[model samples]
Target chain A: MNHDAYPDSYIRGILNSVKTIAMVGISPNTSRPSYFVFKYLLGRGYRMIPVNPGQAGKDILGQAFYAKLSDIPEPIDMVDIFRASEHVMPIVQEALTLKPKPQVIWMQLTIRDDAAALLAEQAGIKVVMNRCPKIEYGRLSTEISWIGVNSRTLSSKRAQILGKGVQRMGLGTPKD
Target chain B: MADAERVPGFATLAIHAGAKPDPTTGARITPIYQTASFVFDDVDHAASLFGLQAFGNIYTRIGNPTCAVLEERVAALEGGTAGLAVASGHAAQVVVMHALMTPGDEFVASKKLYGGSINQFNHSYKNFGWNVVWADPDDIASFEKAMTPKTKAIFIESIANPGGVITDIEAVSKIARKAGVPLIVDNTLATPYLCKPFDYGANIVVHSLTKFLGGHGNSIGGMIVDGGNFNWTRKGQYPMLSEPRPEYSGIVLAETFGNFAFAIACRVLGLRDLGPALSPFNAFLIINGIETLPLRMQRHSDNALAVSEWLSKRPEVLWVSYPGLAGDKYNALAKKYVPKGCGAVFTFGLKGGHEAGVKLVSNVKLFSHLANIGDTRSLIIHPASTTHKQLSDAQKVQAGAGPDVVRLSIGLEDKDDIIADLEEGLTAA
Candidate 1:
């Protein structure tokens, strides 16, 4: 893992800086993966501007859906992608064309493109590839549990030797 | 390169390509040698195996003769250099990623993908220091825009999970090449018959064999296939593949194994350390599934198209989503990428919303009310209530899981029975 590429401290510093995120592929159904990711982010208190052409006029989770990233009235701190890879460049290009370019272009899992990343990099934007912000926020600062019990505590010799217990891992608890 | 017979056609290879009569016992099938370790020729031979001077099994977790057949057969089916089997799809992704990403380094990927992958790339991997950058597979430019100095690979599925949207492989591959990054395509949904991402320029392929590949839904497994085409030696790109490993006598993978080296790296390095080896029993099941893959895929597509058209006309239905449908937004993309057939999985909506969608899922008899897709049996699920239940109201809407949405995984059974079941469900709605 390259900590230099994503400075955890720097990411923590900017946590409060982002007020709104334009989620391009927001879903209304609660079971979708994006739904939980969006839920987690929203629970963290970030305002998400949903972008789905299908439900353009409808409001979801108390947020209004805009047709595109550019259509949002407020400045979007990040253009969180939930669409396919082929659908991203246009959004990224649109993000670039914004009067105030989004500080981050976060693509979802299994989505990737080179031209868009270069464009963002050239424009002096920070790039996070193949990673989810929700997970990062949890792991770096959250009390993510390690695996195994031999019943050891953190930083103790037993903890270092046997690790911890299975229940500790993840704990399903929101550390952040 | 070592000589191996290259058989043409999928079924022919699935049954006969990889294995030969046992040189020792004359057994026709690849026998599962249930053992912990292999006997060495001598101390020098033992030292050689330990030092990585030769390829031989030291333990069941690292390598097995029977599992090798599954890897070889899958590699043949996928038309790649070699293949590696793992415990699950998540494990495969984790191992493949270690080959390209060096913590915090990024990989561009498709947003329309399996739900589990979304969680894996987004949540589980963050602790390891990897990051996911989303891009639209339909638009090559979107992928190009997401690249950065830290970008290692571009990832997408041949046919996305749940939605069954086809990706423009050639277009996405073009962007990946221009960026000088390897294109990684998850061919789980498309399998090899419907689409071969390697032919379209994908350097690496991954699959969750638990789905369509294991048709019976009895086992969980995954595979990583390498095209052996990408040159990892490019400047500062993938030193993991190109550079020498301190663990293995400091020999470079690319220098020795060449194209198939990536597969070897995944098996020897990633799988070795992670201990996510696939069970021989599951590998056998996958082989069984591959035998009928070509035939099953054909019906799966045909039945899906028929069902989509049926859903579009129902008075009780709101909207039908299938790539094969003429007016569907992704139809053109499907035609270009999946000319043979679009997949069996698709989503449609009931006139009423959450209640109606739930009613339809419950009323259906033939359609199994389950979360999985790519099954031989017809399956259905209401994501808003089940899959997306964890998300807040806002998140569900963004994920295309509105109250009315109902997903179907059309099966090998008579399309009529499947439709009849859905027909009753829609009427109930």
Candidate 2:
């Protein structure tokens, strides 16, 4: 993978297919960016599992936190890495050991390691780097653009309003 | 990878950037969401909405679906990260300053500006303890001299009102960068069709949509666009973005919202408390006006240039101040910045002085003698007797609104008709 840019279709496909995500390096503090992302995704109907060693055995937004990815009891469709570049290799290595490997490994904004991405790609797992899933979801769905943020995507198609008059758009997945 | 993604052009964005078919009725036009509040899904959903953890409409005062489309369209046109719509151009200025300025803080602004803005900055803003420091757009060094530790922002107009002076946006932007402040450009006259201030290093772009963006003069509106290039977190200069807030559980806006933090600040903090919101009906009208912005602006510019050229050769006109004409002082900067055209508004001095200006306005047949601009009908105003009446003689001259100056906002009328009407007005004067 070039890792320089991921096409919108490639990102949208992963987002629509993944129902549950495990966010590593999430902080207990609400002021942190990671916590904001976690809360946002949870509100968007994603099953968010926080994996933070410091906050292990506690709950964040009503979701249990585990010390590591292996401790997640259920299958994870994606593993969202929020740590620094130096710590990504060990996490990717650990992800390769899961019985049914996660479909995608997404690194948060400013966190990228080509070596780890290559390792994940070799194991048939999709890898994205230096991007935030929260921002991507907002961009793809036309949510952030409501308040004047540039989503860089334009469509004439009317956004489908879900329950309660809330508008949500899907990646090009047929089931979505 | 798949074929390279195709981005929409300017005209396409102006027509469809923030709009979609109505989801419930499937109406082709965006419906006016005429309600005060929205019903929540439940207690938890309501909590999430109030906490800023979710993005949805809660109240009309903060956000409305109809206004949101207009906001998105303008932001797209300006190539900005985000935009916020407010009541009027002056209201937009107030909201922006509310976010950036504290008591006793100051901002540097160009001396060449709309007479009403000068009045607002000089008298009204002082009540808030926000001092206005004047700088000359003609003298770029005056901007550097006006800077102080108290300066939070630098304000200028891309193409000044009445004078049609083309400001050195890039030069002033460099000074602003060196001073560690954001540069705010009032792009009311230039509009996004003529110039994108962000392209010239402006950190923020503001507009009185009552003008060109709305194209027609039927509606009143304003907008603030975030360029998303300035670092609000640098050295903790902007506490509104850097510091934690107690209102929504202490989340820092810059950290959470990233590039569009300034827009969020203006909304969640400023607009929420100050209470100057753009109505949905006006937003709908503005959105319709913007659909034909490119065509209207081109005609306005073409007609304006033709009229300026005609007036320059007339014996009754002493001087014409339009940057689009050859041999004008600001023509080079105009060509560099707004190559498309110098916009529709410009001023000309009468040989008979202030009384002649008053006579010309009173006698004009095709041109409507009014205080507004950017209308489909040609509008005329004598600044000395009307708009600039509040300013002193020296101040009026400094703002390019001298006693003899008569301003014309050329419209989409035919070039010959506009000139014929101007000839009659000058002959009567």
Candidate 3:
């Protein structure tokens, strides 16, 4: 599903503000889509919260890796998972139980379970099937740099990317 | 200590721990005499009653048989030498602080604490010339750095509010002991089951009976428990305890009451003068709440653990901040101190920041959006917009609250149902 599918500014506005998200399950081994998608999201400035309990408690891309979601104590807003369908159940349960429950639960690029989705949906929790928060953040809110021209215009003309507009953000807000 | 003596198991002692069927009247349940004045046998008996020569109740306001039983029960629950029941938790603080420090003394406190404490320290106490020094508990040196000759006590919450961060009570208590001061802990968040502050080297423990202790959310009251650990007569430190009380005809509290009785002195003298006595009705409600505390606390912990686990996996979730979660920074501390169970109140961030945060709050059906914590029913609140709204952006961040932050006081609900309601809120967020 793309951003324009819902005209409700509520969901759209949310999708716009979120950028780099730490997908807890990004695999360093390139065979995994998590690795490629993670690279793409990192290239998009969204931080990933690593959650491979084994490889967690280490560092990835100079960012501290956590064994689980709760390990990253400072600040984290979104959790994108690349685990399994059954795995999503416990993950969803844990996520809703968070002090501030996550804004959206996207069930990866292929793994979709209506039962899990409905559970999250019932909690007034948002769910996206077969979608990635990293990819969406990159695609929906792209005021991209480089190539010197308007990326939104370029993506519209060349790739037909379906977002509204690009406004420069996260830069130069302070004054002396 | 014997098995039966080790705090007398919560339920058994909450009712029978303090009173033993008043010998004068073999009544089954404790009774309130309700009389303001007590008759003396003769003029010598009257002099002794007022002059500390007799051990009988003379006036209801000064001392009551019913209030004494309530005090004993609270003291047993807290595992302190004695306990004092006050008009409110705020009053308990006032009374205790008055007993420990004089007009120009100071106390140190943690930065991540209740907002009311910050206000009381900065505003109300300032008028009374009592100074409060803020220290970052995370940086142990800040506490030591803030200490001075005038410093009298080190204050902290066993578990902080809203943030759910646990203080290293033993470590802070050590610092206080080294500095010749008492460690005062607000045990409101952790409650007695989750943590016994007295057991962790705290010299005094205070509680707002409004929260978890009164489990059913029925009353407003406060209690103060003296650990009977601090020695007031050792040196020329505490003037109030070592010296004389002018109103009580020059009676030194430490000399008159000995160890366990200083807490009672704070009641008979301090609370009596300050006039912040707890009502019998509130005490009754608190007693009712204390009976099922263990059961309710267990349910609250289990539900919170389930909710925290679900929150970590959601795509739209920004971050989850509960200590029970494996990777959480506080997880190790939780295991060390709160091994039995971590309380349910905690905070998490929404994926979409503010708009999503609003959606999250508006979406949840089962989670009530209210300000109070430790309720049987689950409640949620947005910190940046509500409770800490008065603080500046920097202050909000200092208080560990962000614009996107949502606090959930998970209640005794089915785990799946709680998650289901959270899902709806996350969708809205």
Candidate 4:
């Protein structure tokens, strides 16, 4: 997959299909960007499993933290890397070693490594670089645009509201 | 195949940015979520919301589903990070200042502003211990001269009210940058359709939705769009965003919210406490008005330019202060900023002075003799006798509301009909 620019549909497809996301390098500090993203995705009803070696035994927003991707007991649909580019190759390599390999490897904003992305693509795992899943989710769902950030995607279709008052848009199908 | 991405155009976002068909009822329009409060799923849900760990509506006073749509739509149009909707344009100003200023802090503002705003800054804001230092928008150096250590923000209008003067936003924004202060632009007259302040380097954009954005002049509302460009955390100057809030479990808004921290600060700290919330019904009306914003604003601008050209040639008119006119003083700035015509509102001087100004307003048949602008029907007001009545003689002239000045908010009426009505008013004057 080309990392230059991902189409709205492509990003949306990954967002909707992924039920469980393992966010690596998430911090315990509430003010950190990773913590905020983890919290936001959790609020969006995604099953978030935080991966931080420093806080492996503790929980973040009530979700268990794992020391590494291989240590995660449950299957992860996607591995969201919040660490720097230098640390990404090892994480992607470790993700490849899992019994049921993660379907996608997503690098957070400003963390892009073409070599790791190529390796993941060679392994048949979809790769996204230099993007924030929280921002992408908000943009595709038209949630971020509400506050004025330009969400390049535009649709006249009504937003889908799940149980409770939460509103969400699905990427896999246009009907959502 | 990797398909090329197509970003939505202005009109598309105006209609669909913050809206979707109702989730439960499948309502085609955004419904008015009129309730004062929202229900929580459980104890943890309530705790998470109260702790600012979640993004969900808690009280109508802070956020509502309807107002959220309006906020989002306006924010999207302005290309800002986020927006916060409030009760009125004045409320937006107050909320923004509340976030940026402590008691005894000062903000430098342009003298060429809506008269009511001048009064608000001069009088009402004083009670809050916020000081306003006036500067001439025409003199770029005055903005720099007015700044002090106490200066927390710099405010100006994208287009001055009544006079239709265009501000040199980029120049002022540079001064604001030098002072390490956020520049707030009142985009009420120009609207995002004509002049997006964010694009011109304004850190924040405020609007009175009662005017063009609502289009009909029916409901009164306000909005504060955060450009998300300012570093609120730098030097810890703005404690409201940089400091940990005692209310929200010591959450540093600037660090957590990132680009949109200013908007979040205004909503949670300013609006939450100050208590100036926009009604859901008003939000719905503004949203509807915005759907046709691009269309209405274009027609409004076209009509105003034609009317201004005609008025400039009339014997009854001493001078027309429309930037759309070729030889006008701010014409160059207007071309640079609002290349889409000079907007609907402009002031023209009457040869007969203040009495004639009042007479023209009274004699107009089609134009409504009201203080408001940006209506579908042409509206006229002699600021010296109406909106700017409270200001002194010097202030009146400085604000472009001199005794001879007659402000016209040219509407969507046919150019001939609007011209005819103005001619009759001019004849009577």
Candidate 5:
């Protein structure tokens, strides 16, 4: 995928397909963006496995923390990097060692590692750098539109009325 | 470089969160997006937007750029995941209830609430078949007893209106958690500057932006903030959040939007159908009002404390009921939750009774005789004759609007002038 200007479909496909996310560098601190993103994905029905060496045995929002990606018992669908750009290469390298290796590596906002991206792609993994999954999901699902953010996608179709009660974020139901 | 991960402070967030300089004009302040509808790029784009596949401004009533900034700013201030701005404080209440309750669902609410909310709940909500079980906020056990299987939410005001009674939010929150219901705190009296309900485990926060948040009496608005904590999908209690939504191709809001789903539910389901969209112009004014919230709130608290102290000593006054007063019953709770001070609004009683209450309101000079609170100018009201006139005598007293009670919304005025004006009102009474 082109890092500079990836098409919307590329992002939509990744968001729709991913089920479980491994958030490396997840913090216990509630104010941290990583913690917010981790909590967000968990609420959105995505299973989250937190990875932080310092908080290895501790729990975050009741989810047990893992010391490393390899410590996770199940195969991760995506590895979301919340660490500094300098730390991405090690995380990507470690992620590649999983038995049923992850399909995607997503870096949080303002974090990009071109060398790590190339390595991950060469090993048959898709990479998204300097982007946020929480934001992408909200934008693609039209949830962001409620707050008038210019999501840059529009359609002529009127919002289909679900029932007599309230309609939801235009985003479709999560497929198991 | 180390500053990359630093979260901005409250003062910084109040000014810059959810906003950036306009790319086109480099406008320092957010410009009002006044147009009714936005132009779509093509047929595909339009289809995507309506289908909820893409996000963009489609119509002002549904969403506006100006209102979006205000929503984000308030959400950030309240430590919430998301926020929805509505036409008035009452509209916000309606939207929140509309999202949480279907016909026949019940919610537990604190008796110490604004008279308008009590009326809205007791009458308007009953019409919709949403039953409200009123409980005393002072007794945590009262909230626990009010809970039933049908209870979907627990509602309370932080630093309640009229009496300035500080609620024990954390204790009530425990009951909500055990009952598997969301705790909704109306933070109108104590803005986020004084107390962020989210910090004490509130699942949602509602505000009448018409009050201190707008700071001035110029605009009327309200907001609902999703704390993003409650598990809406648990036990399938809240179908609005857990069940598949038919409108957007059976999309489940709780499963898609995560922590922010409740706010989205309010927007797409309630605001869209209810048609209580906040005007972009009013959004603009309120956004500007929020920029000085910290400064104004501190001064408001300071001035209110002084006035409360002065009133306690007056022989004409039967009692003063500001939580910020050291010996007030709610003073300890105020110290715990609203340590910044118990906000600027409070009520007092006259020794001369109902006739004196009416005369005191009439005699005040610098203080405006008005129904609104949280204005820059001091405001006084005899609620029994005005806001609570419709309620029966017993109901009026229960809502802290007794015949002899007078409410004052202290302003950011010279403390001496405010005291002198009240002195004049007392002498006349």
Candidate 6:
């Protein structure tokens, strides 16, 4: 799929389906973008398995981190790559070797590897490139539009659900 | 520049980060959204906005588009996650402290700060049940000793006002990190052009936009930038972020907003309740002023250094206490923190004492005898006789306002003209 041509539904579908994520290249430093994305997804109810060789055996946001995706005992629904484009191919190969491979491969902001993405797609995994899950979550939830960030799915239609105590995030159960 | 991976340079970010041509009118400049409230799409839109599920302008008192631009620009320039603009410098202080401390909590503050800030911390904050524990910035060990179980934050000025003393921010930030509290740096005197506190490990940066930021001194405004470097979620130390807030229907801000939660909290709770909103008109003025900060700061620093050197040579001048001067105690700190320049405000002592200080303030023709600093025009003030007049002699000295002291906020005039102006003051004294 052309990454830009992928419909909002396609993007939203992946977000709703993903339950557990293994974030590679996650940093302990709060100022780093990886730290924010990790904490944000965790707060949004996704179980995060942080994989960083340097910070292995440490805890981030109360979750014990592993040196690599292979060390995570539980099945990962998605693999979020925070490393550079050059590093994504090896990370994707590593993800493909996992016991229960991730259903989706999501690259972080500024990371795009067509070859790695093609490999993931050929292996029956979905691919998202050069996008931030934290920003996407906020965009879909209409949290960022107020501050003038374009969410790209402009429509006159308001959300059908109303008057209930709003969920902090606009995520929901995956529709199979 | 279109690539997201390439970080924009400082001048580019300062000019373009939070601003875009008007999507509605195609105005090149960020136009002031001067209305009181925005029209919601429907009841559900309003509800989601109020419910915190959506973010948008609800009322002017809480947020405005023009002020949001100013907030975002400064945040980008400071390398922070987010920023909130408020009415005045003191208002920014109250909001930031309110977000961090509850009643009975204490914060450690550098004693070498602006005279007005000293008054605000020593007197006004006491009424809010937020205690200020003073620590001498000259002695880095004093900050560590001032910390107690009640300490919620560490506060200092990047380059302290009136005296131009550059703080050892990295050293103080380490202490704050060890204590598990945010380090708040006042970057009013040392604007982002001179120093970026976040680069040295500050968790939050507060600025008096009334000064250097609003360079022409046309607007009275302030900002609070969330450095996104503090773990407000750890151990429930910051109940305001980690715990469910009673006002927002038990919603936890940190859980919802991630790194920018402190900035959001200050806007949602602190400014919303305190009601110290920066007017949209002032926001426009300040934003315009910020577009020229890089140019003005360089000139201001150059002029101040030359003026300080001239003052140092005067036989009637007892001492010049400018960090830019090599022989000064804070010179080394200035080189480390404010390498671009040591800012334009500094104090000097007259050999003839209080009478001469008064004489200098009275005689300067080019310098405006005003309380404000960071104006385009030069300003001279005898703090002991004016700004710090209420304090006792000993208190004045402690606040860097001795009877012989005369503060000069060197302006962006030709160096010879500024020297000539000061020359008249010295001759009269």
lDDT of 4 at B266: 94
Model 1 residue B422 lDDT score: 83
Sort the candidates on DockQ, descending order: 2, 4, 6, 5, 1, 3
How would you encode candidate 1's per-residue C-alpha lDDT over A29-123 as one tens digit per residue? 55354665676567456888889899899987787889887788878888889888888788888899887888887876556777788888789
Q: Which stretches of candidate 3 lie over 4 Å from their true place?
A: A1-176, B1-7, B22-46, B58-60
lDDT of each: 0.73, 0.88, 0.70, 0.86, 0.83, 0.84
lDDT of 6 by residue, B1-429 (tens): 212235667777667756655444667788888899887767855765676655668898888878887888888788888889999999999999989898899999999888778889989998999999999998999999999999999999998888878789999999999999999999999899889999999999999999988989788998999997888877568888888788877677776676678998998898999999999999999999888888899999999999999999999999999999988999998889988888899999998988999998898899999999999999999999998898899988987899999998989989899999889878972
Q: Is 4 or 5 the stronger prediction by lDDT?
A: 4
TM-score of every prediction relative to native = 0.69, 0.95, 0.67, 0.91, 0.76, 0.78
- Please give, for residues B1-429, the per-residue lDDT of candidate 2 as tens digits: 122266678898888877767656777887888888888778876776677767777898888888988888998899998899999999999999988998889999998888778889999999999999999998999999999999999999999997898899999999999999999999999989899999999999999999999988999999999898888886467878888878778888887887889999999898889999999899999999999999999899999999999999999999999999999999999989999999999999988998899899988899999999999999999989997798899978877778999999999989999999988888972
Residue range A35-64, candidate 2, lDDT tens digits: 879998887779999999988889999999
Poorly placed runs, candidate 5 (over 4 Å): A1-104, A107-176, B1-4
Q: Write the residue-wise lDDT of candidate 6 on A5-116 in tens digits.
A: 4555667788878899999999786545577678767756789989999988889878998998888999999999989999999999999998788999999866899999
Each candidate's DockQ score against the native complex?
0.01, 0.49, 0.00, 0.38, 0.07, 0.08
Show model 6 residue runs off by greater than 4 Å. A1-134, A137-176
Model 6 lDDT on a 0 to 1 scale: 0.84
**Cα RMSD, model 2:** 2.2
Give the per-residue Cα lDDT of candidate 1 at B84: 83
Clashing residue pairs, backbone N/CA/C < 3 A, model 4 = A146-B72, A147-B82, A148-B75, A158-B21
Q: How many clashes does the backbone of model 2 have?
A: 1
Candidates by lDDT, descending order: 2, 4, 6, 5, 1, 3
The DockQ value obtained for model 1 is 0.01
Clash tally, candidates in order? 70, 1, 57, 4, 12, 0
- Candidate 1, residue A58: the lDDT equals 94
Residue pairs in collision within model 2: A148-B82
For each candidate, report what fraction of the true interface contacts it reproduces. 0.00, 0.44, 0.00, 0.36, 0.07, 0.08
Q: Over the stretch A1-176, how does candidate 3's per-residue lDDT look in tens digits?
A: 23223322333354545553557676655434465455545543566566777786667656677777766675556667788776888877777777666777766755667777788778876667665543344323321211001111111111112323222122111110
Indicate whether candidate 4 or candidate 5 has the larger TM-score: 4
